[model samples]
Target: MADDSLFAQGMATRRAVLGDAHVDNATARTTEFDADFQTFITEGAWGSVWSRPGLSKRERSLVTLALLAGLGHEEEFAMHVRATLNTGATPADIKEALLHVAVYAGVPAANSAFKIAKQELAKRQEAAQ
Candidate 1:
């Protein structure tokens, strides 16, 4: 069984970072096939790691975005790019992180990530204004 306290903590942090609308949609879309996977991520990723005190949310956001990009996880990269705004990471910081990905991860991955970031950032700007 999942740790209740850790699960609660993870859910709270996930909602805060990803936003209620996004999290709600994600939860709603969870299927029987992936339910266990979702639970594991919440209990392990969000609760065990992301909730730790070692890194600031902003730092974690940067690392997450870069790692997702490096792995060619475009959907996750886009989601995190949006989440970065909530974590106090600026567009410039994201761009810089992606630049680092270009050198370390590969230019193709960074290039794709930049496109997704630009699109997501533009959407956010439009929503705000």
Candidate 2:
């Protein structure tokens, strides 16, 4: 975004959803060539859209999971699933979302997403203990 304030808002929203640790890792790994891309998503996706008031972050998390699963973005889907820690998406919500993916996105996409989601969820649960 052209406006620094808007970009800052995006950064905050992104961090809120993705968690500071994940965002920090992404930032640390950003190269000069990809820095522009980072800024664009931070401003456009996280800042402008995610910062909007229309949808709660929890609902956004469900929609994001469905979109990512349907798009076959397994990695991004898994990342967003991890983001559920902050987004308040329950395991049941993820299961329901994946069921939607199975119907619309096909069973294969849902299968992969379920595998990743289960693994990530297990990791989080184990870490919590």
Candidate 3:
């Protein structure tokens, strides 16, 4: 698909996964320097990869969580943990993925990821209540 089409598709997917509020907040904070970076992630990551039909969003979410946890991207991991609500990734799925992280990514990474995930999940649950 063309870049424009990819960007459009990516924006839609991003919104669906991250929600309008988060997207809008990011958009609002976009600066001249980071504008291209934002577009790159939208077109490349969300459009080209996420838009693919090979895996369900739930599966993608799990993979993303594991990768982020493995890389020790605590903030992004927490954000994706919250995005699981829209991605249909359950707490069980997240636990399994974190277990994989522990085995492959190291106990320290998984330990930190687990802590962040618990905090984010608790915030979501509290909000729902």
Candidate 4:
């Protein structure tokens, strides 16, 4: 059985990092088919690894963003691009990571990720004062 305390802790941390509104919208968008997957991510990814003391949230965010971009997960890449703002990762850092992705992952993947990041960054900047 999933640990309720762990799940709760993960949910709290997830909200803090990802923001309540984003998490709420994600939760609201979850369907029955993906319910288990969502729980696994909450309890496993967030509760387990993210709660560990090994890495700062900022480091984890950087790794996660790079992996998403490298893997060509555009949707997740966009979400994490916005998430970097809260994790203290500047747009320059993200651009640098995408450049690295271009070298290691593939130019096409990096290009797509950069496009998504640019758009997301623009939206985020506009939302700010």
Best by lDDT: 3
lDDT of 2 by residue, 1-129 (tens): 356887899999999999999999999999989988999998899989999999999999999999999899988998999999999999999999999999998999999999999999999999999
Any runs in candidate 2 off by more than 4 Å, and if so which?
none
Stretches of candidate 1 off by over 4 Å are: none
The TM-scores, one per candidate, come to 0.96, 0.96, 0.97, 0.92
TM-score of model number 2: 0.96
Winner by TM-score: 3
lDDT values of the candidates?
0.93, 0.93, 0.94, 0.88
What does candidate 3's lDDT look like per residue over 1-129, in tens digits?
348999999999999888899999999999989999999999999998988999999999999999999999998999999999999999999999999999999999999999999999999999999
Cα misplacement distance, residue 72 of candidate 2 (Å): 1.1
Query: How far in Å is the alpha carbon of 109 misplaced in model 2?
Result: 0.8
Model 3 scores a C-alpha lDDT of 0.94
What is the C-alpha RMSD, rounded to one decimal, of candidate 4? 1.3
Q: Which residue segments of model 3 deviate by more than 4 Å?
A: none
